[model samples]
Every structure is written in C-alpha cells, then in structure tokens.
Target: MRYRLSIEDMEPNHWVVWVLDLPACFSSAQTPVDAVALAPGRISAYYSWLSSHDSSLPVITESIEVEIVETFHSFASTQDQEYLVNAFFEDDRRPPNYWDVELALRLLQWTRQDLLKVVQSATQEQLSRPMVCEVRGSIAGIIKHIAGAENWYFDQLDLALDRAQLPDDPLDMLKAVRTNTRAQLVKLMGNERITKNCDELWSARKVIRRTLWHERDHTQHIAHLLAHL
Candidate 1:
C-alpha cells in the first residue's frame, strides 16, 4: 500500500519516513533510487545482501503529545503590571529537557506572564493611548503579536491554536493555549532527535529553552525601544 506523510507529521530529528498505515508505523532511511537494477531477481539478492551485512538498525519509539493554550488579559494597570510580573517570577522553574510537557507548559506560562509585564512596563500610557513605539506596536498589539507568534510554535507540533480553532474569549484562549501546547510537548517527548521548525532562529536545543530566549529577546527589544522613548 502507498503511504503519505505530511511535513508536520514527520518525526523530530533524524530523517524519518512513516508508513501511513493503521496503528501508525515508520521506517528508517531508504537507498538511492538509482542503486539497484530493475530485475526481478535483484530483489531477493538485495535482501540476501542486507541479511549478510553485520549491522543493527536503530530503535524507533512512539511520538510524544504536547498541549498548547493561549492567554488573555482584561486588567487596568495593577493587574497587568504587578500580577503578571509576580506570576512570572513564581513560574520561572524549568525542566532539564523540553521533552517534559509539564515543564515546557510551565515555562511557556511563565514566559507569557513575563511578556505581559514587559508590555505593562514599557507602554508609555497606562490606558489605551496613541504613542510612537519602535519595536512594540501598542499594548494591545503586543498582546496579540505575542499570541500569534506563540501559535507559530504550536504549529510546528501539528496542533491548532486554541484561540483560532476552538474559542476566542480571553479565558478560553488562555485555556486553549495551555491545552494544545501541553499536547504538542507530549507528542515530541519520546523523539530521539527533536526537529525544530526554525533552526535559523534557534539552535537544535529543546523548544522550551528557545522559547525562553525568544521571550527574553523580545523583552530586551521592548526595553531598548522604551529606553529611547
């Protein structure tokens, strides 16, 4: 039977060719198309040659599941500034590996809160007001941009954004971000080589570390912009 595989469905790390059959299976690398003759007898000869080879195949494991969710804010000043900063400070713990969905989720949540704090502190006006900012567009724009950018990361894990797929309400967005991100993390945990969607943007490390660095990078960007203002 023929099998089809989507880029997102491809296993992380190592080149993997999955068999699109029931129960979900995968295969290792294949030989060059030009290597063998198209003779009927060539097939058995190839298998015999393969059996004679003194080598062992690598072990393949099942995929991990990760869940992702979005967060929304509906606060004036204190809620936006103090609460978010405090929450982020509390959730700053990280797991040794991004393979752990629980740790990744916790770090993601902390980074989200950290971003909100930067937005609250960086904005010139407490309430909604037009002001020229360089990196950060606006307070609301910052929130939306963060949500959208994070969704890109979720897409790498083959999960839909909760805010986009399921609901749009603030509380619901937060819940969805949490759920989907976690599921995605779980999906990739067992992968021996975690494939990163944007290797140019980050190294081949776990997405959790890249995420923290991304948030920190943006925070510094906003800080530089705000400093000039």
Candidate 2:
C-alpha cells in the first residue's frame, strides 16, 4: 500500500511526516529525507500497536511505501506561530465512530504510561538539570511540555480546561491534564465539529491526532534522555 504523507517542515531542521490515513501517526527527523525515511517503521509500529487493542487493521507487511501528498513549511518555529496543515484533509472531517474513539483512548492511555515509566526513578537534580535547546529545556521541561500541550489540544476545539489551577508536580500535572483531556476526547466520539482559530484548523480527529503524536514523541524523547543518565 502506498501511504499518503503530510510533511511539516519548521525552522531549524525540524521535519515531521504525518501519515494522513492513520490518526496521530507521525515521524520526525532533522532533515526531510531522514524524516521520510523513518515513516515506514512508524507505519509498521502503528499497525501493531493499533491491533493490540483493536484487531481490525490488516496485518502489516515488512515492506512499506509512502508518498508526500501534502507539504507545509514555516521558516520560524511552529511553537512560535500558527502550526502546519491549515486546512483539514478529506479524512480529517470524517467523524470518529465509537470504535475509533475507543481505540484512540486506549492508545493514549498506553502512551502516557510509557512516558511515566521513563521518568519514574529520575532524581530531582536530574529532572531539573538545565540543558540548552529549543522548547525542550530539561527533563522537567519535557514533562511540563507534555502536560501543557495535552491541555492546549483540547483548547483548540473550545473544550477548555482550567489551566490556571493545574497541579505543579510534574506527574500530578500530567495525570490531571490527561484526565481532563480524556474526558474531552470522549465527548468527541461521533462529534462532527471542526473549528478555526486564527488561521489554524482543528477537529475532534485533529485534536486526537496531535495529542497522541505529542505524547508519543516526548515519551521517546524522555526515554532517550534517561538513557544517558
């Protein structure tokens, strides 16, 4: 199968290739070629992961093929402005059925668990040790980013949370945001709503997509960070 891809190239060598057919399935790398190179493996892994909870997708083969169907680039960081994929794809508007939502919820739950496990035994000093980089500051910053971005994805759909009173403990904050975000995600099952804020576009599917992607992205990030310590 030739999978369709959506590439988001942002400032400073950030390249993310999104598999439009698979919600929340994305691969990132420092260059476009490397990013695209990683997509086949991500596609294979996603099928195995999806099949764990729902055995509907066909058994994936070893050989995976992909083509760049959509491309968006920004010279500045995506975090600094309206992000990529301004308009929803044809598949984006299709309201998720009960099965879709349930599968997504399962994926989210597992992804979060993986993230927590990576940082389970890190010392406070290790968590807060400053490291100069982009939005990713330190281990603690990654945790905060994971939590904050989860809540913000909900905000895109007008499914707002009381961000002002969020918990400060990194783990507590992660749990709280995910709990609320899951509630919001549940409401999105069969929802046919899509909203535009500024020039950015979002839908129930989009929110789920971005939320899962961010969680998985940072989980691997934290795991790599932990490997060095």
Name the top lDDT candidate: 2
lDDT of 1 by residue, 8-27 (tens): 11122322222111111222
In angstroms, the error of model 1 at 154 is 1.7
> Global lDDT of each model?
0.38, 0.80
Runs in model 1 with CA error above 4 Å?
1-102, 119-128, 131-136, 162-175, 192-206, 222-229
Tell me the TM-score of model 2.
0.84
- Judge candidate 2 at residue 207 and give its lDDT: 81
| Model 2 lDDT tens row, 16-38 | 88898776688889998999999
Lowest summed lDDT across 10 adjacent residues in model 1 is found at 83-92
Error of 1 at 194 (Å): 6.6
